[model samples]
Target: MLYHCFLLIASLRSVVAMETCPTTGMPGIPGIPGMPGRDGREGEKGEKGQPGAVLHGGLDLQKGEKGAPGMMGYAGKRGQNGEPGKSGSSGIAGPPGQPGDPGAVGVQLKAAFSVARGTHEFPQKASIIRFTKVITNINDDYDTESGRFRCRVPGAYYFVFHASLGNKLCVLMKLDQTLIASFCDHRYRRQQVTSGGLAVYLSRNQEVWMETKDYRGMRGQQNGHSIFSGFLLHPH
Candidate 1:
């Protein structure tokens, strides 16, 4: 009886070993996916995704725009200064500036005058011809009382004069008693007009004026036809 019981127990053990248990975990091997559920009636859209980094791929792959630039990196320490280079040889000196046009000497002397007391003829005596129109008188160098320009600056000057004569007229221009220019008309038959100019070096206080040869010969016309002008050309 004991031997029979032992044999029965052995047989039962063998049968239990041969029998397998149902699998209780994920499938050991991939199984055919079940037909997707009817997508469960479209769910609410998910939150937007964060921006991505700049992509480095074919142009076709870069559908999305480039991402914002990365934050600037921390500044680096300054580098040591480099050694100075050797000085180059001195450059050739420039040609002496063309003497600079005498710098326009600062003397401001200019004047223009016309006969004063119209219709009043001058005397035969070598007298100063006064002027009425004080067109321009700088430094008061020209006198309207006594038609004359007294040189205040020692420099070369230019002078001009105009005279209208009806009868025989003779006008002489004198620079401090020195004859400069003369305008004469011996033809007492017709009217005559004369214009003249001169440039001369004048010393300080030298006077310039005109004198009539004959008072009756040089009669003043109602229309002012006499003028005198002068200006410093250049200072010595």
Candidate 2:
């Protein structure tokens, strides 16, 4: 009986295993890690990559050395003229100049005449009074025969005349044929005196004389004298 029971139990276990395993048991514990592997061989150099993009951020570089001077360039053409500038202020005056040399001596020009009437005689109308007496006659410009003065020097001259008149007198001083001055005096039954003077510019060879406008009234010698006088003021 004991042997048979043992056999029966073994048979039951075998049949149970053969049919299917019971629910699986819990997993086993993990194993420890292995030693590290050695490094692999370096790879082959890749083809030159495309140029990289410019990076803003980079290491700062040192300053570069100074460059050599360049060659001289050709001269440029002249530019156009600019507008006129404002005038400058006047400068200070300069010192005075040196004194000049003295001038040469000049020639002296002289002409003068003075004449008086000697006799008391009535003169004809429109005729020159002939003064026979001569008080002074420089350069002999006055002619006693014609009773006229011919200008030898072109100049300004001063002429004066005085007449001793009896009854009535009218005398005219003339330059050439032109009347320059006149004097008339009338005092009935009484003696009187008349005088005239003029300053004239005369050219060379121009004539001057005194004449009576009327035939009457001249007194000289015993009475007051009639005189004509002239002198050069300056040569032209």
Candidate 3:
């Protein structure tokens, strides 16, 4: 006994130091959850994090559903012709046109004539002074057996004559073979009375006569002392 083996090694080191010492007591009743362990191999992507701090005053957002019509865009190059517009001020004048219908009733042209000389003969050089007294040949345009007047209406006439010379005469008045008027009485055994006139413009069977350059006098008077007249002063 070496002192009874040192008191049995000091009572087995005080029972192994009270079974390795760590016991503050009461926290041991939660342990029956254990079947979730196999998922741990995905961890390397973390270094880009520093930009998120500008959000001041939020809360007002309910109006957003109109967006589905966008696919027709390739036609834009026709824009260079627009500079000519400044002339507008003049419009007001229309009212007055209605009155037309009533016309047709004219033509009444009536030429005239009057003749005398019923022969006391003394007119025969370039002779054409016949007249057997008609005294008013309305449109029988005078031709008392060809002492001519013939111009059955074409314009401006008015001829006239009156001669009753008794000796030397020389009258003329023609118009076709034109020499409109003349008269010379030469008094040789005078019994004078002479006259002549004209205002011609005939054309339409044109004639008109009274020619005796000098085949001496004439005194044909049955109250009409040698005459010749014409009229129609209008129609052309």
Among all candidates shown, the one with the greatest lDDT:
2
List candidate 1 segments past 4 Å from native: 1-117, 122-124, 189-191, 219-222
> Which sections of candidate 2 miss by over 4 Å?
1-108
For model 3, residues 1-236, the per-residue Cα lDDT tens digits are 79999999998887887788735768889989999899999999999999985544565555567999999999999999999999999989889888655442232477788888887766677778887778788757787888898887689998988877777777788889888778777765656677778788898898988888855576786642888888888889
**Window of ten residues with lowest summed lDDT in model 1:** 108-117
What candidate 3 gets wrong by more than 4 Å, as runs, is: 1-107, 119-132, 139-156, 162-164, 167-186, 189-195, 200-218, 221-225
Output the number of the TM-score-best candidate: 2
Q: Write the per-residue lDDT of candidate 1 for residues 14-60, one digit (tens) a residue.
A: 67766854335665887788986765577799999999876678445
True-vs-predicted CA distance for residue 90, candidate 1, Å: 34
lDDT for model 2 comes to 0.84
lDDT of 2 by residue, 59-154 (tens): 566556899999999999999999999999999999999875554223236788888888877666778888878899976899999999999889
Which residue pairs come into collision in candidate 3? none
- What TM-score number comes out for model 2? 0.52
Measured with C-alpha atoms, the lDDT of residue 43 in candidate 3 is 97
Better of 1 and 2 by TM-score: 2
Q: What is the alpha-carbon lDDT for the whole of candidate 3?
A: 0.79
